[model samples]
Target: MNDRGNASARLIAPLATLATVLLSIAGAAPLRAQGGAPPFDVPAWAFPTAPPPRPGTVPVVPDSVTRHTVPNSTRHYTRKQVGNAFDIPDWFPRQHPPMPAPVQYGVRPEGRACGFCHLPDGQGRPENGTLAGLPVEYTVRQLRAMREGTRGSANPAASPNPMIAVARGFSDDEVRIAARYYARLQLTRRNIVREVAQVPTTRVAGLLYALDGTGREPIDGRLLEVPESIERHDLRDPWVRYTTYVPTGSLTRGRRLATQGPAGPTTSCGACHGPQLLGTGDVPPIAGRAPSNILRQLINFRTRARRDSTAASMYPVVDSLTIHDMVALAAYVGSLPPSRTPRK
Candidate 1:
């Protein structure tokens, strides 16, 4: 740890200078905007919305209906069994919902399944997070944070993130069960990140972005990552994947900032996240995560909205970043392949 700190200190000054200049240019708003609206200061893009129906098909409401049929072997199972995230469909089920029936499917009094947003695989969308391979202790701590209001959504519009309420409602046993289940899964890489000057014209739909037109539009220093299969994602199909579109050269810039700080107030991620950035002990892995999710977390740390002993260390680390720097760092981290080693 001493050697790591010394090495990280070497890169801070240059990165800090670059970050200061970038922040001045971008002002204080987040890097993206919705429709023709002014750029908001919050990370509102982290929420997933119910996507629209294909060309002419009727939209399937996520919780109210089952668009796909269950297997023959389990066809006789009750809704309590089928609906539960824990009692998951077994047809090539890559991951299982770890919670009990009520927690997986959700009871009317409490709300939706824990997997409904995070997904059964624990590889959540940009709006949420990848829970796979997280430390059980770290996971439990975060749940406590949300329950205590020490951590939450930074976007005011996304304020009172449902997870806060969900955490508050959970029993200690339930949290432990869920955390252990997720911690046991192996991490896997998903989204493919690319930097481009122009991107498909998109509209802010749901808690994500959707391609809106064939006509190309400049990314304008904004980040847009969307699912390749809108219909499947809306169906809550666990197999769906995504593509992240960022500004050209963002990855290169991000790589520099991540592996070696330009100076200012940051250090190489490897200094603490392990040499591979796959995480060190209680520190969670940042590699191969959704860029949008990474950006949201960095923003949270900067704003001190995610307060905890661990996050307390992150505040100073992110304070010097410009929105552009955040975008670059997120892109670079999300581009790496996830560590596949199962946690002990």
Candidate 2:
């Protein structure tokens, strides 16, 4: 074989091995099911977990199709009818990016609306990526990656990564419209990261961490972060914000890694993410994103699950990160207030 073929083989060998291991592990150990058990059961070395729900009444899963409704035109529309939470008051615009029918409704019997998970505001949940404020090129590239099978979740059992399946079904025009709409929206700080010795009781409601009641418990070295109110979040109320709790000093340690790169496996984040770490030319801003998401992305890079050209840039940094190091890095990066422009 030629040198290029050899190089490709080298990369593919380990990834294929890893995939086999993952499939084996998944078959042996299933992730905790929703409601039955905690929803987020990622390897501590790879991803963070939400604190266990406090014992009490089962936390209400926001599943009432009729209850989750919003006004559209002159009548109220159910979540299913709207295809997304776009109609939620105080959150979405009446008509954003003049969404094409494909974006507002599904392409047909199979394709789901883009806004279903991304929301009309484009601020996605921890389970998915935040699309708002991304550069159009960057968004397009990711969609293409999904279509081409280069980008995917490292932990499929933990996160099915619905986008991969969805993207595969999208036409080019649908991809363009969805990308443009999300790109046009602004990226803002909708969440804060806090380190705590103990966290409030939380339950896994679908892909969200929700408070089960008004009580706190030792996190036992685990991290738990979620929106204060699941109801408000479902409404897509922009005023609704999220709070993430981590072990104390994780942020401080993470700041050191981010700003100094103590051991030299990686350089200071400012080198790439800009002085303030908001973002650079094509690099999307990571400052205000969810810590879980950041940690997940880092893990994906390490495992080669996200092997797009841009993700390749992260391999060196993440490969050297220990789980604790990842936790610290995510905590610190997530703590920084989001900035859109470079410092003057």
Candidate 3:
């Protein structure tokens, strides 16, 4: 009986040892298949990896940093430095190379790369004026004004002139190109219902006429009442003049006031801006622009907020505008269709 029990014990111990060895081999099989590397293999050389770059230690500069020295050796001129070293380019003769082709904005070809901000559509935001379907000639003239500092906001105190800065970057041909692109786009028709409620009481010229239940009212003497429901529609006004949203009648009235002096003022608009209010070589076109924008500018002139060398020329003209006249003039200018330079 003792010998049988001992034999059973020895057999059980050997079987247990065999099972343990099998289990270990099964576990080791995956490691062998995985090339015997640790789960996260640390390279033998990198094992004690320099204690993770002592906090905030200056990083080792790569050798590529030395490439910047090549430009220093060549001494290439920066824009300002070049201008300072060389004479100013000639204004009339071929002093500079022809400008590069303009960047296209959608179907429209922006002569001056209008896509930088206005995007493919001329529906620019409040920061910049919309240029879709505007008169090409007017757009060019305004760009000229901005570049030459002849036409701009009446406010002089505003430190940086955004329009002026933009204009300064464009050449004459570039302005023409951009203007032409915008002039061809379909104009957006806005259902403008004049809002009488928003109109300042001080600015109201006459008794309100018809008040639409929608809050717009027409005032006497052609003054557009505010609160007009200006729904942004996709249609363009066929009667608009070059690069401008103003109507012909409004432009005619503005012309009369600008040139012949309506009511009280003496000189004509042509005396400063050319005939047809098309603008002189340097002056900007006033025939077609946003009425609201124009009104704001005229007010700025009245308030002495804006200033320019040309302000003296407009002082007498603007000084004569009664609140009604100002409104009428703005409306007139805004109503004219945009004009364009005929393609040669």
Candidate 4:
């Protein structure tokens, strides 16, 4: 098995009892704010909120103390060291290949390392795009798209653009270096799709959500994806898997939509991406990626937030879709396995 192996099977929660379709219907409302005269309605749930304010007082940890460690980690770092925004904490460097300058330590002042958000393994979190096993050419194109004005967030008010800043700041050589390194690394499955009527209450932690397990709320048609353990997540564990709680029956409905467009409103995803949704050629794999990440891309394309030539085909596809339709498609797509090849 690959040294990191994937998260254990138990990490993915199974779908609980199904809820009526009525719950999914409730989220059909459009976005309250408009970035432009969007061709399609934007859904608020697709955007992540800003992280909660940090406590004014953080318990001091002296440098004399031994470095802190996470379970099974050989690397150790002090709290101050681990929180460095310019350098990524590669808790398990052996888990993947070596990182380049842009991947490990980005340019000071303006650029942030790709690994800081995409993680060392490139599985990525709900907040950013995944780079693992992506096409080298495609990756470069995306970086160019971000550097130029072709790609951007549909909801800029939700959070500032980290990718855009990095794209604009980094030199072209550094961009190519980061792209090739991550492109060679295989992407493991880290998303666990589950359908449930209720989900544990959660709070925004950084760009993603973390469930508290103490409270519960009705799953009224939105996907709630959070790390299995916030403690492990806080450690920046690359092996951490996320469980996405989607409204009941979203998966089944999504499967039909992906395989067949029903009428002519949407196109079958398999038509462009491979039948497995693992992508083909320049198209990147969608299987087992973050659902929120997927949902946002769909929304962005429809809203013209991403107008690159690559996304041209998706504009019409997402244009005719509703909020619930997008949710189901994201849920079903996230449920698929990213790859079957074992790593070591």
Instruction: Tell me, by TM-score, which candidate is best.
Output: 4
Q: lDDT of all predictions, in order shown?
A: 0.64, 0.63, 0.39, 0.72
Residue pairs in candidate 4 whose N, alpha carbon or C atoms collide under 3 angstroms: 2-343, 2-344
Cα-based TM-score, every candidate = 0.74, 0.74, 0.38, 0.82
Question: Residue by residue across 127-181, what tens digits does model 4's lDDT show?
Answer: 7868998888788888788777567656543423567767777877888888889
Better model by TM-score, 1 or 3? 1
* Candidate with better lDDT, 1 vs 2: 1
Alpha-carbon runs more than 4 Å astray in model 3: 1-256, 262-266, 340-344
RMSD of each: 11.2, 10.4, 33.0, 10.2
lDDT of 1 by residue, 1-344 (tens): 01112112221222234333443343322212212222224333343344345798985444544335333222233333444544343333534544554335543444456676776668776677888888888988998887765675455344456676677767667777777878877667778998899888766556776666566867766677878776555545555678898999999999888888634325778877877788888889889888888988887666555766677667556766777888899999999888856332
Ranking by lDDT: 4, 1, 2, 3
**After superposition, which runs of candidate 2 have C-alpha atoms over 4 Å from their true positions?**
1-79, 82-91, 94-97, 262-266, 341-344
lDDT for 82 in candidate 1 is 42
Better TM-score candidate (3, 4): 4
Better of 2 and 3 by TM-score: 2
Clashes of each: 13, 0, 43, 2
